[model samples]
Target: MKIQVLFFGITTDLVGSSTLELNIVDVATVADFKKSLKEKYHQLENLNSYAIAVNESYAADNLLLKESDVVAVIPPVSGG
Candidate 1:
């Protein structure tokens, strides 16, 4: 299945792109997608934590992804 991934904040720097069209095995879960991303982009593993949002809503690791789903990688935010 194919999904559109959006990178926010520092994630964009880590992935080297604000958006990506990626392919994954059918019925892949959010956790699976995160693992695949960490494998493909090792820099992503450097983050302390991040959130995965599917179709504008925060998604759990078990959420099953669907073709053409829009996923967003939102890195932790820090400010004074």
Candidate 2:
């Protein structure tokens, strides 16, 4: 199975790309994808917090992922 991942804010800077086409297993979950990302992109692990949105709404770690699912990596926001 494969999925499209969208990167936003600082996540795009850390990942060095705005979009990623990932090849994963059929039983992958949101958490699983995140773990894989942290393994491949160690910079993400240093972030204060990271969030993921599936489809359009914020998703939990256990949320099941599908082949065509659209996952977005939402970086934390900071302001003065």
Candidate 3:
């Protein structure tokens, strides 16, 4: 299955792009996707704090990813 993964804030720097289409098999949950990302995109490991959005809204780690799902990594905001 193919899914779209998006990166925001500092996550864009680590993943080096705003988004990418990924081909994965049996991606049941966000945690599973995170593991794949940790291995394929090691830089993401350092970004422990990020929100995952399925299609557009924020979702839980146990949420499943569909073939046409759009997952975006939303990093927390920081400012004075």
Best-fitting candidate, scored by TM-score: 1
lDDT of 1 by residue, 1-80 (tens): 88999999999998899999999999799999999999999999899899999999999999999999999999998899
| CA lDDT, every model vs. true structure | 0.96, 0.92, 0.85
For 1-80, candidate 2 gives per-residue lDDT tens digits of 98999999989999999999998888988989999999999999878888899999999999999988999999888899
Backbone clashes (count) for model 2:
0
Q: How many angstroms is residue 27 displaced in model 2 relative to the true structure, after the best TM-score fit?
A: 0.2
Location of the lowest summed lDDT over 10 successive residues in candidate 2 = 42-51
RMSD of 2: 0.9
Residue pairs with backbone atoms closer than 3 Å in model 1 (clashes): none
Report the CA-based lDDT of candidate 2 relative to the real structure.
0.92
Model 2 segments beyond 4 Å from truth? Answer: none
lDDT of 3 by residue, 1-80 (tens): 99988889888898888889998776569988888887998997787588888888889998888888988889888889
- Model 1 C-alpha lDDT versus the unseen true structure: 0.96
Q: Once model 1 is optimally superposed onto the true structure by TM-score, how far is the C-alpha of residue 47 displaced, in angstroms?
A: 0.4
| Separate clash counts for every candidate | 0, 0, 0
Evaluate residue 5 in candidate 1 and report its C-alpha lDDT on the 0 to 100 scale: 98
